[model samples]
Target: MVFRSQRLSWPLRKGLSSVRVKARAKRRLFGRMLAMKPGMKGSLIVVVEDDDSIRSSIAEILEMEGYCVNAYPNGLAATEALKRTEEPCLILLDWMMPVMGGEAFLKARAELSESNQRVPVVVLSAVSERAQGQPGVKSCLGKPVDLNRLLETVEKLCLSGKCA
Candidate 1:
């Protein structure tokens, strides 16, 4: 019995037009409860990225992988959504943005949050400074973010319920 993450199961459906593949993927995702990505039926991912292309691309990739992802133009939007504490099992936040950059947003969130204070955040940015010795961030990806690494972090944090 091979235990795989749900993120792997969803993408298999795209290339595989066969009924067997779809069934197998569904079975794999449901049966392997221990390796499930989120707490509920669908996991939501929040991405605070100013770059439209990068944000869309990343969101599309995660969505294809079966995770429900939301992209924000800046931290404020993502932060507002975070207050609801509904979507996004994890957050992929960019270090730089026009208003309320990642650092400020993070600080504000920490200060204001009564609960959901430990939301996992992965710093996806072109700047290396944010990644180096940055506090309260789970992971960091340099510019031209690596898709594999991003997915890995998402899967790990979403599953474990803690930022690395």
Candidate 2:
């Protein structure tokens, strides 16, 4: 299961509690790097959604969690973004949107080279839609995503070189 239970250890929470403010400040700096993860290499997460509020909110959360998030108003925009950029480090796709939905974008992204297509995508869907094992994408995530779970999934995908 890519999305696991979010149960932080007491010790870890205590440590985080001590540096909450520092974490917040460091979050944006790291996010602004256009990647998240240790070393020069970092992970890129694309958040595709039509709703402005949802897209912005998720962007904030992902950034705070130390992720390079690129928010798109729709899948078409995301596709164009992909063309300009290197590849999808990770994709958080909203199911329903105008002008090329998430599934369409997924199909398009799947056709890319394995090296480029290997970017794992976690679909953010409201309905019970799903994307089976594609060249890159990880799995489906029901709407109202648990941020902690999303973070865990991102960490797992970034570190393990495989979607959970």
Candidate 3:
């Protein structure tokens, strides 16, 4: 009688027998799940930056990491869009822009309904310290932002479910 181990060919059995292959697959799956953390799926992140390159790059990076992004050229456009669309999970605001600067946007955002006013803002500016005590401002990152730190801050805030 043929033994069970002898039923399969060596090549087929060898492919399935490697512990490294199984471990690698498990790690890949876990890494993907970790990248898009729970409570962050489908979350929208608004980016308001005057520089075309900066806005596009920021949006691209966030999208790659699994968050939906809506980028605006100026604060005025962002404020107007905010009224029409669902509230975003977070706003990345640049300090200076041609149409409406960050300060003006913050003021306008304050005058909105209570729900809109609660949305968290992260100021990305040359002088980020100026925004420290501002109401609704959750965090500040200076110009030439560290992408890793930005991601970490976003993960912390969004994971807490407070930004939603």
TM-score of each predicted structure versus truth? 0.71, 0.70, 0.76
Over 1-164, each residue of candidate 3 has an lDDT whose tens digit, in order, gives: 21112111112234454455446545654576577655665588899999887888788657656678999999999999999998888899998789899999999998777787888899998889888888889999987777778889887776778544
TM-score, cand. 3 vs. native: 0.76
Winner by TM-score: 3
lDDT of 2 by residue, 1-164 (tens): 13122321112333344356446547566665665335323456788988787788777666666556788898878877787786646678887789888778878776666655667778777773656554455777676776667777776766665322
* Better model by TM-score: candidate 1 vs candidate 3: 3
Better of 1 and 3 by lDDT: 3
Which residue pairs clash within candidate 1? 44-88
* Per-candidate local distance difference test: 0.70, 0.66, 0.78
lDDT of 3 at 61: 59
Better of 1 and 2 by lDDT: 1
Sort by lDDT, top down from the best: 3, 1, 2
Question: Model 1 over residues 116-148: C-alpha lDDT tens digits?
Answer: 556777898779466555555778878767667
The residue pairs in collision within model 2 are: 121-137
